[model samples]
Target chain A: MSPTTTEDSTSSNHGYAKTSLNTVNRYRGRGQYEYQHVYPIIDEAPILHVAFHGSPDQDDFAFPVILPMLGCTGNFEEDPNNDGRRSIYLHGYVSSRIMRLSRKNPASNNIAGAEGIPVCVSATLMDGIVLALTPNHHSCNYRSAVAFGYAQVVEDEPERLYAMELITNNLVPERWQHTRYPNKTELKSTGILRIDIHSASAKVRAGTTGEAREDLKDETMRTKVWAGVVPSRMVYGTPLPAPTNMFPGMPEYIEDWVEEWNEKAERYSAEAAGL
Target chain B: MSPTTTEDSTSSNHGYAKTSLNTVNRYRGRGQYEYQHVYPIIDEAPILHVAFHGSPDQDDFAFPVILPMLGCTGNFEEDPNNDGRRSIYLHGYVSSRIMRLSRKNPASNNIAGAEGIPVCVSATLMDGIVLALTPNHHSCNYRSAVAFGYAQVVEDEPERLYAMELITNNLVPERWQHTRYPNKTELKSTGILRIDIHSASAKVRAGTTGEAREDLKDETMRTKVWAGVVPSRMVYGTPLPAPTNMFPGMPEYIEDWVEEWNEKAERYSAEAAGL
Candidate 1:
């Protein structure tokens, strides 16, 4: 059965409501609108593709633009209303921050629209390539989440640090405490954007190749052409120390984290091929 | 030396002009606009994140939206002017086709605006995670490409088939010839979008951790904390056949492609760590 149609998945508790904009009309069976289903995919993706309107000043760019950014989902505080809404924090430099959220643009201030710069964030993890009998039926086994929201720069120093730490730890577990803390200049130069989720949904596909009934019945074609999934995932190799690194050896936390993630990624992709 | 500053890189031969709209202002040292430099990144990426403005009828949505799609860059014909211009083809279903490029949007027709649906496509490959002495200095070693374009549905059957075959082969080398041919119904059901790239650029960072002079000078902190790159890449695992697959055995082409890609992935991630 599809999780999209399941009862628990439809619960509003700590879940995003399906809006006309965020609803997944195609492949409805694979669509999900729950926080549990959506957030993990976003967190697992190393790079989040963020899309926003180009600077209004640049009329040549009628198209919206996309910037691949480092970010992850996290909540700074528990939901006061018990309805669990969270934000995605992003890491950026001062120049990129200025380019994206220029003062010249009215809506960039989040004042005109009463919301921050409109943006959409997407994350996708390709589990495998599903090779079918014919090119038309070829598909990908992937988990993708799209989040629609307004993004505003985190001006508050504490919140900014909170986001920076969260983004850092997300990349390497327990990395924040292990690394040297940021000084005043480093803190000032680093920019963080917190995107408040307005609506979100996820679509997942994990299984073997899908065959049409007609194609499956054609023994000659079936026997001639191979049909299968080439399972795949991002793998973390052994860490390579920097030239100036003076640590006695690789830290236990880093070593273990690498192994754990590699195992998990391999296991999931291989298992998903069978599912 | 940075490619962006090179004279040959600035050549207009089969390359996009460095417009203000597409310029990489933040890290000018890493930006690239050449065809050879940018197209491969998009083709190598398994998934492309596409962003475009919502339909005009959907006033409720002020934000641009992103869709994770399967696509690859290809040139259907040689450049008439000897200046390389290529298009990226995307595979989509009919249902999703109508939702994204509806009749209601004026620009969707490419008539009034003299351009089809405006779009921005991004592809990124994270080579490794750079663990620095401080959290602020932590960065990702990656190759990322951003393409700005106008998309129009491919109506010509031959062109659509060309794109389809290209996409299928891109997934697995020689896959199209080995598979069963698509029927008329199958062909009709598939939707292909050809995005004529207007401008594009790529950014690459591949190396060990970048350390601050002050942090490097502090021997105590350097001795205590680990600094390195955790090389990472998308690895293709063993192939698993479908339940209904009637192939006698795994094909040699598939096997070779898998092995070759897996080796390339592993080698690149590892070598890029110390670059």
Candidate 2:
């Protein structure tokens, strides 16, 4: 159900929109968010982070809702018109000490606190799995986005410990300047929201292979039972370290970002090691 | 919020039960059929399908209604007693003919369909992509599955061409007696839908470090940036055949399934001829 609506906020500037960090987030129910673009003013942009997974491991409770550009070297390719890697995204700017750690977690207590929907948060990472031969036609091949707007919370105190050290040095740029920052009760129980530049939108869909149109010598869509697609990704390798890090070398920007993550882990490990 | 509910339907029909192949077509949005853990007794199992794609080359879309077995394929060592791969899937259950070709598309005419809501599906395939080390903490170390029940719509005619020749011989086993079967206008414009397995589940997560809660000795969860996870799969090498058939050769069950996909491609061919 491709629905849409969300623009009327004129000023009151809530931030977001360096082209809304390359929009795409879809995972309905439990913090609902949607914006399936068949086209609607190319869907707006704002709101960013919402990458959850407190469990089932993905590096537990992953975070990314830190926005605000300026001197910017979260090197999203140092702004190729803020490339947004393909589409756009950049949500969460929360910093009221993480909204009092989500109001001391009773799970973000009352009136739907997470500080009531700030603004701009778009995410989408459903990249592939179209195994069809029928088991209710196993499907999946996605990439979504529709982050609306919010984040403006970094409440002073040394810019809330420099926006939590620019979100831990923009997510571990060699460990936020040699670590150990964030105190004063971890910056008074962390939260730092921010959004503006016109809230979010990053419409996408690589829909190809609708296949199924046999008869012309009927090749049964070339079946073998193990058809195609199983790509799936979200990678980054070569960090290991920390066996009690006294640092046994390795760091020229972590050996050139792990030789570019061993060349994208040797081309996605030779197609999942099945060359 | 966990919130479970099942207090009866025969106690939500526990594990491996079956039924539903058009039992008086009870119209739920024209043509009813959909069930997971097909309620015979008590609990939950709504549909789940999470498919995505937009890059890594795109074509993504997956329907998820929270943990409803992404679509099924049980038989984990032949049913590990109703934990049988801890069910939560929603795959092709024999491709309900691509939701009957998106119920005559007009952008799915006005979805709200599946009034009979009972659909179990599960799918898994992600040989790798575990790249960690903070890039907003990357992850993807998987195999994945979980499916639970309900489907009915095979409208007679010899159980709809013997359930499309048992899903084309469960996906190509001797090409359903060497091809060519569905006649009566390809079984009345082929719609076929059937699933009756009261409760079912399947599970698997797979390697390259996935145990979680080592909590990496939390110095703020390590992060020199560049952690691991970037495997990914969908291998089914050797098995070409059908260039127009006539291979008076190749059939000992297609040479034992192309010698079991070339012995899993020569034991994952050095991670598929790495890079």
Candidate 3:
């Protein structure tokens, strides 16, 4: 599958393979293990839910923490969507819990006899709510991806900068180039994590709702209940100028990006619902 | 906070209070601990990320799992938003790991009696991306809520039904009344977890983007960087009937609900960005 430069790039080629960690147990048919399919969903998502075991050595009580993080998947030299090999780059405060943990446990697989923090990152985009005649059949039309990887702190300055640039561009194309580059102080306070993905899977549920055959046969129930797909799309409204913005008006790039995303969101959502 | 019958009832009063578990450490000013403020965000969100610690007695590796679950906040008697006392009702498959774990460890406050399953439920609604002249100041205008609670399997039949009804209504108002009621078999296969919220807090960042004073003073940086809020909203598109739907077109309730939610999503998003 080729990646679509639009929102909800659900149609993409196989990139990751089925692994024990990334296998979709419940809805096997909807699962796509290829990197091409999984990376797009990861890239398109605005936030990634990072989950890790809290206090792994403690046997008294186990707590898992999941934090909403800003991240992107790509290498510095290649486009994330088109390239087969991609790593997730997550940004956090230098002294953050996740960052500190990652620093202590650096990636060692390549060097042998090394340990790294294990993390599971998940991203989801809801396309529509599938309303069925029966409540049992009600489902959501969504695109979701889960990735298992080892995360390590980025010690290299160039690699960290590259990751930061990728994350900024992920928010808005060419946003990094437009914004003031990070200074030494800013870079010192920020921490970057490079998650080397071991396995990943993408699950997509699209099209119309599915009703039970028995429910359809029941005329009373069929007439009384409405079964359909309520397509949900993320739209970008008109840009609002900042209080400190001394500029005359919103810039052309901001306007163009908003318009482009709005159109893509509507089109992709419609397509997902088979409109 | 009185719950609105209409879609996206963003207007509500304070409900929950500050506690040790639910306090916002990083940005204290943005934290809101009132039930009125927290419930609406939890209700408006499409999905809740449920995080819990994996095996407590194991000396081996610990794993934290985060699952996207369908849920709502309410009591049996009154509207959740209006009522000060509320519990989060989460719906899931009976055989799911979270459900099984929650059932094994019932919530108990007394010492040495029993260990309750501690869980953190979080919901986030992204309003817009706040582009700034400098990368350090860039942020997202969003409303997020985090609740710390002890989760236990809901065994009481009436409360279970009530929770089910609340969750169904959350999907679309009065949805439970229209769809065929669940049978004994259906109810048996499904499980509901009542998270008795001990503490909760909401963090909301709204209005336009904020640029650094230094960047604002720099004329060239100000002119080059486009700093503004690109409002993001989730919209509901035209409903599409299922192939098995023998009914004549979409129902009026479905049509009205879709239009109402679409408007609310747009309105709330714009308001969050101070557009």
Which one is best on TM-score?
1
Candidate 1, residues B1-275: lDDT per residue as tens digits? 11222223333666778977788888799998889999999999989999988765664358788998888987765544445556799889965843347323425533224346888999999999999999898988899999987787777888888999998888788999999999999998888888877779999998898899989899999999999999999989989999888999899999999899988988998889988
Model 2 regions lying over 4 Å from their true place: A1-123, A126-131, A134-138, A141-152, A162-172, A175-226, A230-251, A258-275, B1-275
Q: Kindly report the docking quality category of candidate 2.
A: incorrect
**Models sorted by TM-score, best on top:** 1, 3, 2
TM-score of each: 0.92, 0.25, 0.86
Which of candidates 1 and 2 is the stronger one according to lDDT?
1
Local error of candidate 1 at A209, Å?
A: 1.8
User: Where in model 1 is the C-alpha error above 4 Å?
Assistant: A1-11, A97-114, B1-11, B79-81, B97-114
Which 10-residue span in candidate 3 chain B carries the lowest summed lDDT? B1-10
Q: Write the per-residue lDDT of candidate 3 for residues A57-171, one digit (tens) a residue.
A: 4332234556788998976545555546677999988887678778766643222222467777888898988888767678888998887667788889888888888888898
lDDT tens digits by residue: candidate 2, A143-243: 44443332234355754455445544333345455433433543454444433222343333332222334422344533433333333333333334333
**Which candidate number would show the highest lDDT if scored against the true structure?**
1
Candidate 1 lDDT for residue B140: 88
